[model samples]
Target: MAVATAALGLAAVLPGPASADPGSEVRISRTAYGVPHILARDFDGLGRGYGYAFAQDNVCELADQVVTQRGERSRWFGPDGNDGEGVNLASDAYYTGQRRAGTVERLLAREAPLGPTPELRRMVQGYADGYNRYLRETGVAHLPDPRCKGKPWARPITALDLWSVIHDVNRVSGTRQLVPEIGDARPPGTDTATSVSRVPGPARSADFGSNGWALGRDATRGGNAMVLANPHLPWADGALRFYQVHLTIPGTLDVSGAGLYGTPLVLIGHNKDVAWTHTASDAEHGSMYALELAAGDPTSYVVDGRTERMGRRTVPVTVRGADGRLTTVERTLYTSRFGPVLSTGWTTKTAYTYRDANADNLRSMNTWLAMGRASNLDELRTAQDTSQGNPWTYTLAADTSGDTYFTDASAVPHLTDAQLERCTLPGGPAEPDALDGSTSACAWGSDPDALVPGLYGPSHQPELTRADYVANSNNGPRYTNRDAPLTGFPGTYDTGDRLGLRAELGLRMIAERRDGSDGLGAPGFTAGTLRATMFGNRVLSAETGRDDLVALCRAHPVLEATDGRATDVRRACAVLARWDTRADTDSRGAALWGTYYDHLMESRSPDETGQGRALADAVRDFAAEGLPVDTKLGTLQKWAGVPLPGCDGGKGCFNVLEASPESGTGTPTAGAFGSSFLMAVELTPDGPRARTLLTYGQSANPASPHYADQTRLFSRKRWVTERFTAAEIAADPHLEVKTLRG
Candidate 1:
């Protein structure tokens, strides 16, 4: 990433003069597994150390992201290049449009409490300067990762660029989902090259799943608070990769845990008195509204007996052509008062627009930093109530006071029952009905308590304080605690009685251990026991369907396959009968049962022949890969040259390692997603005992010694003991220290 002006100073990148002082200093200590313990005097120095250390490890990825957030992907790369979100052209146009609208600029212009405080701004500036310092010292050509070495797109980044990255994450569940649609939207009959109408609405819920458990003293064997954070995110090397670090400012700040690649906050982890984690929530953060367009004028819509003209912004993207020449392509994007107009569900007679609850949410980092500084669960809840900045996740936390708390206080559209009943139109996406965009009567309500308008206040969202436990596995808050079901929230919040397979399995795991039925020889959980159970790799689908499937195969010695041929099921039935119902590495027939379950889910019907064919196909797939049908999972599924112990499909595996084909082959050689970072934290009286493991290692650069160290430990189901205190930091034999002055 090349900066257009190499001489742009750090002061220019910062918003104000209240950034890091001229002689700001920071110290970074690297413990085992190359985890950095950064000590500074204040937030600015802390962010400086963090940003410098993070760049030392992940400069390539961060630099590429700077280009991405700047809407220069089409310029630096090509128009068709994809950065895992959408095509380059669409991403460029979407962000360029936002820049033109001055959205982020207006956000920064707000007053302190609602916008960014001075401390936050200073920290952001310090981070930007720290990253730039690293870049200046190392020189772009000498960067470790050759991919971005000497690349023009890998230039020094600004604090505003970092802010854009933060905003992108806050809107991941909302506006980010409509990048292609917003970029390609056009007036009807004006463009013949439009393909936006064929685009799909937001997806990716299943891609982000997790099991978060917050256990109080009543559920703990040691009478202490325990939290288990098993977030199942993508294993691919990108923005979502969790970087473990311990940030400290003596008495002012002390926290240990992980944050995403390009940010300066610790998103999930533990402080001295509390431990917290997040699970992706099923609540809706945005709504798609149907616009009543005027006849023969797609750009004009009628609202409450009045004609309203849609807002128009023409965004031009500069693309690097195949011949290395730059050319400009322009598109006219439309918007209503509700929000940006989407190409999906748009026609000459009607159009669709979307409104995101988190569009202006800039305080999420404030909440996270507050959570890190919180001394107890009440403080945690207070931080939540005040910031209400959770983007789209449920907060499950446990404090040393033996209290467990759970809340879906994430940003959500504030729609009342009356408004829902009065403004519903059939066939909406995500929601049961598209909101009536024609009138202000259907608009989202506001509360004086809410920091943002058109969003539910923190008090209105689901929340609970329990002594036993609170757990969520990417499900609604209704069943956070099975014994005490929460209800009466609006449909937008996803209140319901039903639990998904993963949710049911997660709840059952807690109950069985609490009742001493899980063969763990205990009635309550200990940090050690919780860690063991997380890696237990129990496959619920196999336990429920394996026997029945085997019996069916036995009853029919031979069955018809999907190819209209006979498949012998006797061998499959025998193998399943003798197989252990777990997704462990050595479990025979686990792969076959996984295939059968996938077929059942897809067919959504009892197709006996299809099951037989699925089993047969599994066998054939193994044979094609030159392995036996009963081969150990460890022998087949390997990532980073280490055998991944968990199962491939979701398949009800609590310890999940979802896998995908290698170069389109049927054999899965790598984990594409699932179980990225696992942590078990216990707030013991002896100052917070915790263990964590990042499935992938610390650095994306394979040349780094830390690249696969933790990954190998994860393969063996091991963890790195967190070093939070100064003594623990000094105790590591592999400790290396460096200090920076600016």
Candidate 2:
């Protein structure tokens, strides 16, 4: 007992909330599930409400966020936190190494305050103060540091951290725009061109995709319109949505649903008269800058025609242990207008400039929060108008009008080709660079609201033309296209494999339900899951996957299509498809295809298909593994739990990404993150009745019964009831209660 106390007590001596202050007073009401019904008066109050709620469910993660956003990781991570010189922290190194840190930093330094009115700025700052107060008032001494040890204190919070987080949140307001650097490329005649119509750069790839839609009067049981939320994210922090809440400030606000950590408001979900869900969108919302070095060496560049020496800023990074002495490893950094120039000790010393709509996107969130309380399209559009951060947005909204509208959103930058050519720094250019921020109109000034061609008025945002509307895995800002695709690489657009298999099957199911009719109601909405499953099956049915892949079923005729046993089969099938029509993984046929792609990189000119390349790599890697491919999706795909490991236990168990196990790369055989937080909502005469199902439910803490308790319902594609009314919450049996005040 003495030894344990001594060890635990030392944590108290560590640094904690240095700027702790009393935060905004928040009132909380709890139902049976330990979920809170919070009421806050205004924005700051809401921030307090959120910070308190997040702290309750995930104090450790919340604290880590504060430290990370503030860039004060080393204080908590110790000497080994940053690179050798001791600067950043674990998340900082990994996040930045992935080439996004400078993106966040530059956005803040150069762009965050772009539209902040003094009032808005103060409100944001107040929210930060309130958050810090929560940390103080709670007297939270030590927080769990899961990434690295020796750091126990909660660190600190600041007003700018709030700004920084919101900036990042809204910057990624659009789905695909979130990581433009990594998305599936559009072939010349795809749908994206009419959307973004502006920013498109070197690297374009898509990791995976999702499917979701709304059913009107025609397909429901109760004759009410229904909206389905089936978002697919790699089960990880900021990847999946968490912390569901029902918030009401009455006249000021009354909304319900979920939001991810780090973000202040709900990124996606529903309110009273509507439900909004997002899949990836095919929009070119990100831009890369061409950076030039300062007046040094032969590569010296000229900025503003002034010989001002380029500023060399070095950023240090950290590695786990140093020489077994329990320390860190660090590196230096340099930056330019195009942003930081980075290297991973590889041959590619690539110089790139990247920008997103996320930097000053606080308004994007402001509008979302406002929509929670809005009752009509006018009010919703009002919110949409103020969504300053979302540059290329694909927004779909359903109103009481029985009308659905989808608008290609964002303040599209209008940079001229001339500007793109001249604004570039000293680097490479015979014809000049793709875009130089200063010279290119694409990179700068103009009414961002003006560039979107069709975004002018009513028809610009089209909704469910028929009473039954659908938005499957297209991730596109387009209404269903009837005409054939046009040919051309029009600037500011993404044109590729825009439509996926989901759209094919979703439209089929909708047609069957309505009998080619309109008016979809509640009954049709309730059968959403059935529709999804049927569509998935029907589409894959036509494209006879691969003969060799299907034949593997002969080996295990009566396959147990449950959990990992079945999941392995799918992985095997996915592998076989990559086999170049051969049954064997290591067949000469497979190598033929492999060598083809390899030679293309060396032999071909500019390789345009980032999507094709990524997908090809994934396939080829699986083929090299020498494994039999199976043909059942469910047979080899199952949700595996992502377990948080203890300090002394084996390395932590975490999310199961969709990757080929045979590749022996990416995640292990685990697949914990499947469909989480599935909700089917319908607007009825009585109001809104929602069926919500969560896989690995509400609590991130594994110890809670809520953890994985919802797993069964998730697999069945069923749902547990969710009621915003006080009376309903009172009825839940497992209701746990906690009082939160700050």
Candidate 3:
């Protein structure tokens, strides 16, 4: 996606900046977790350090992405193949389209007036180079392909390879750009509905969402700014690029945060002066305009007020053939103004108009890089005004001023609710049938309001409660309790369930102030407050008397439990009490139950159930059916699908979140996906730094000795500090060093 020149020739992709000196070096050390504490002399060196370190374990993923960028997936895996080959095929198609995408590329190329600064770009490139160096060092030898069953590796990677990888990253970033083509399988009674509401789907779709929050003392009265980032994502298929690093540019900046592969800087976390976070807007940023196919044929459609050819794009995907060699697959891509029109709808004569923030060419990363250097409130807002990245969400930042601002900064096409409704399959009265998968379907309403999606009408900006503090990663500003109801823009849009828990309880904690003061009525209530306020409500519900388990527990006060397990009795109870027993976290009960509304302290109604389902309920159910109140967590809660849960053929338990563990009664738990990556910051007159919680240990390699090693600490709410200073990084005896030349 990185254009090479005015001619718009796509740059041949490259690896991390190649080392100018063959002897130039970088070093990495393993800390408490497998998280690498990298040390390098220059920005490029640092990148190489991280790259080599990451590649040691996840080279396969890295290489796959590299293939994806060049649209070479089909070449390696073969075309028409759905498994490994399909991805390559798809990637190839997208890349091929990009090569043909003059207009699209031009639009994507628009610099967001600003983006990552030159210095930060160097840093990003530095990391990429570091990764390439790893390829050079280790990929020189053939490695086993667990998926393909071959010695898959690199003889030597070039910068072109890295560029190819970025090419894939760009494609992944725009996966939502294509629209599904509606075909002849139209179902009955489908047109009467108003707006798109779970019309029959094509089966499954992508799973991705994130949660981030910033809490201040007015909210916590704690002397620091706390940022929690939980990006909920499916684990496999190159879905996440998680890296936790503490970047110290000396006086320029200092921050402890999480980064993705390919990205140079942290996505969310706290710097010296402030902390910022984000969450998806869940707005129908992408809409579909029904196509009136010529003579009811599914393939032909109208564009620009005239019947036009729907450019046919065929993707050849490679997969493992029954005979073993990779095979080819050919898939079709048709276009409308929105982008590529897909075939998804059943028998409905329509094509969708694809749109999303991905279309925004503004410097999303550049804006963030500037964000890292922002010192005060005004500068922060200015940095944000660029509206570079994902437009369908908002980013919130808070500084020492106890000041916070929320902005929907993205170049969004102006499409009204009326316009959006028209596009819905079950669209309302005014459903407009403009079938071309192009921009004409959903026209930009305006630019001023387009770039900024959220409403800043009258009232007050969502701030750290004067009496409290609040922040979110696309978790809306509903948590900051102003006098108004939790209605900022006035509609229910849930990007993910975690945001629900965060917003609902975040407000409750802020509003539950016993004192007339603006903040929570406690002296130093951060650590315990989190345990009591957030974790407490979900685990310990007021519900009672549904079964005799409560009465039995009343008889036995303490349950002998192991420490450190988030699912242990104490931990389990705390988490359970705060969460509503509902699967849809956006439900009012989700907020109320977690908030301990009128009934949090009160006993449960006879018919009401407790917070968690499986272990707590199962054990309590057993007790009600003649078991002891003193049941053990290990004995009841078990790894349901662990393939093999028993060590010596005995059962052990595992916790589920976001969604339920079992098939029936699919209610989710807060423990599911709340805090995958959490870091707490302390930036006072004393300056800034952080403490972190990364759930599974850092490295992706399961075989490495350091793998999963940090899980023990993270599970216990413990953190290992990041040593950013050169001296500190070098001082560790665990250091392993290597060098690479460009």
Candidate 4:
């Protein structure tokens, strides 16, 4: 793999203000497997080192994110470019409107104490400068990645650009689903106020989200705390990718874990005394309001029985023309007191306005920094309380003291039950019903003694500290633990009641000993046991339902011979009946069963008739695709260009390896998304012992050896020991050292 050339002047020394530049103070050591261990004198130095190290590995990805955040994707990539779900034009329009509205600056100014502090501002500035320095020294010609080596989009970024990227990521998930609605504009009539409509929520997928587990002293072998952090995210997207790093500022800070590309702080990681991770929560972070528009003017709405004109801003979006020229497209965006007016395609008459708790909040990084600095569980809780930074996500943590904690730590809107009842549409609060916007009654934090504007304070969020164990598989706070589940919280806080298969399996694993005993007894959970369970490749569906399904298939006489397909289906049943219920790569019968399950889910058939039809459909589909009914799971779902075999456990399995049918033929399965990072941390008398495996690797540069090193390990159900201590770091034979000075 190519390393940054010496011609790039790695030792360049540029003098900045004395306070900002601590002269040759940032040192980065690349240990075995290309993980950077950064040692800095202070926060500013730390930021610069992190920025330089990360850029060395992912400059192209970082540059692409900056372009995407600036809403200039259309300008660089063309307006017709497909942005996953829609055209680049939609992304440009939405992001351009956000920038034109001065949302980031305004939010930064309004959010006091919770916003970026002077230290954070300096750190971000240092990060920007480091990134620019890399680009200046290693010109586009020296760029290792061919994807954006000489691309105009890979230009130098500024501090403001960094801030914009952060803000964009914070809200992009919720806004992406409303892109079409955001760009729609039409005239209003009397029917606009009376029409009933709802803004559709993003499709909920079991394939997404994460699995977090924290075992306390009582649940562990050595009477210590243990935690498993497995976050499921897209492996290909640069923005969502997690980079491993160990950052230290002497006595000020020392933490190790994973930070997303383009971010300055470790979003999920651990200090010597505490370890933490997050899973997407079931709480509603953003809401849509149905506005009562004026008879003639669609941009004016009725609020509190009075007419109010919607705020309008003309945003200029740059798009590349067919002739390779850049053109400016102007769009007029409308916003009501509730929030941005969104046009639901179902009806132009009713305009849905969107609002989220994290829309403009800038305290997320600071909150993470505080968490990293925490010395114990109490201090971690205090950090969460002080920043209230997380917009939406459930946080789970464990400490050296054998204390485990769980909380919906995001800033949620505090709406009383009475308010919800009065404002809720006929669809009820659980569904995506646009609340009546004519009165303040439906608006978030409208109560007389509301905690904050458009959000609930930390004191009001659901939190718990358990001495036994706590876990979540994105099923909400209701089922954090099956034995002593958190309850009594209002439905508005979390509408989900049932446990997902993954969550159920997690609880079961934690509650039982490795020897299959009922409870955590003499041989309880250790770091080894936790790691074993995390990669067990056991499918709950197969363990519980496969036998019955196979029996059902046998009982039903093989259908009349319609070609040889019927015989194949009977053979599949026999294979399934004899097969074990695990999803290891070598497991047989999984392909047949998985195909049938996918068809069953797609058909949404509940009755006996539906089951029969689904089975027949699966058989026909497999035969059409020319696949044998008894194909091995690995043969159908192996990784591309690699010998790494695939597994059968999917979506809601404890050892999740989610995949989807290949495009076009749709018989062979391709890995879609699953465990992006799998880490297990155990607090011991000596220190914290940790091991981790990134499904992909540290660098996005395909040519780099580190790009898929960890991925190969993950494919084989293996992990690399995290070199957290100085001794561990020193023992790495492949260590390379670099120093940075501003």
Top-TM-score structure, candidate number: 1
Per-residue lDDT of 161-202 in model 4, one digit per residue for the tens?
A: 888877755654465456556654434443323122344663
lDDT of 2 by residue, 247-326 (tens): 66545566777766655655555676776655544544444555333423312344455432333533344433444333
Clashes of each: 6, 67, 91, 0
Candidate 1 residue spans exceeding 4 A from truth: 1-23, 82-86, 196-199, 202-207, 428-433, 607-627, 648-650, 663-671
Worst 10 residues of 1 by lDDT: 1-10
Q: After superposition, how far is residue 92 of candidate 2 from its true place, in Å?
A: 4.6
Worst 10 residues of 4 by lDDT: 1-10
Candidate 3 local lDDT, 1-742, one digit each (tens)? 3222311220111124434552244445555455565544455655566666666656666666666554555565654445332333444666555545443345434444533345544665665666666565544444433432244534344444543344333333234323112211123234422122223221111124454455555554555555545554433335355667655433455555776555556667666687776554443344345555544455666655567655665555445554667655445556655545543442345544344434433255666666777886577666656444433445666677655555544333444455555534454333332323433544544433234332221122222333234444344445433443244342223223333433443444445542423243455446435433322223222232112433433433333212212222333333334433432222222322222222322324322233222233333333344533332222222222111000100010001123222322222222133334555555555555555655444555555554445544433335556554445556666654433334
**Sequence-dependent TM-score of model 4:** 0.90
lDDT for 189 (candidate 1): 71
Scored by lDDT, the top model is: 1
TM-score of each: 0.93, 0.66, 0.68, 0.90
C-alpha lDDT of all candidate models, in order:
0.80, 0.44, 0.44, 0.72
Task: State how far residue 86 of model 4 sits from its true place (Å).
Answer: 6.7
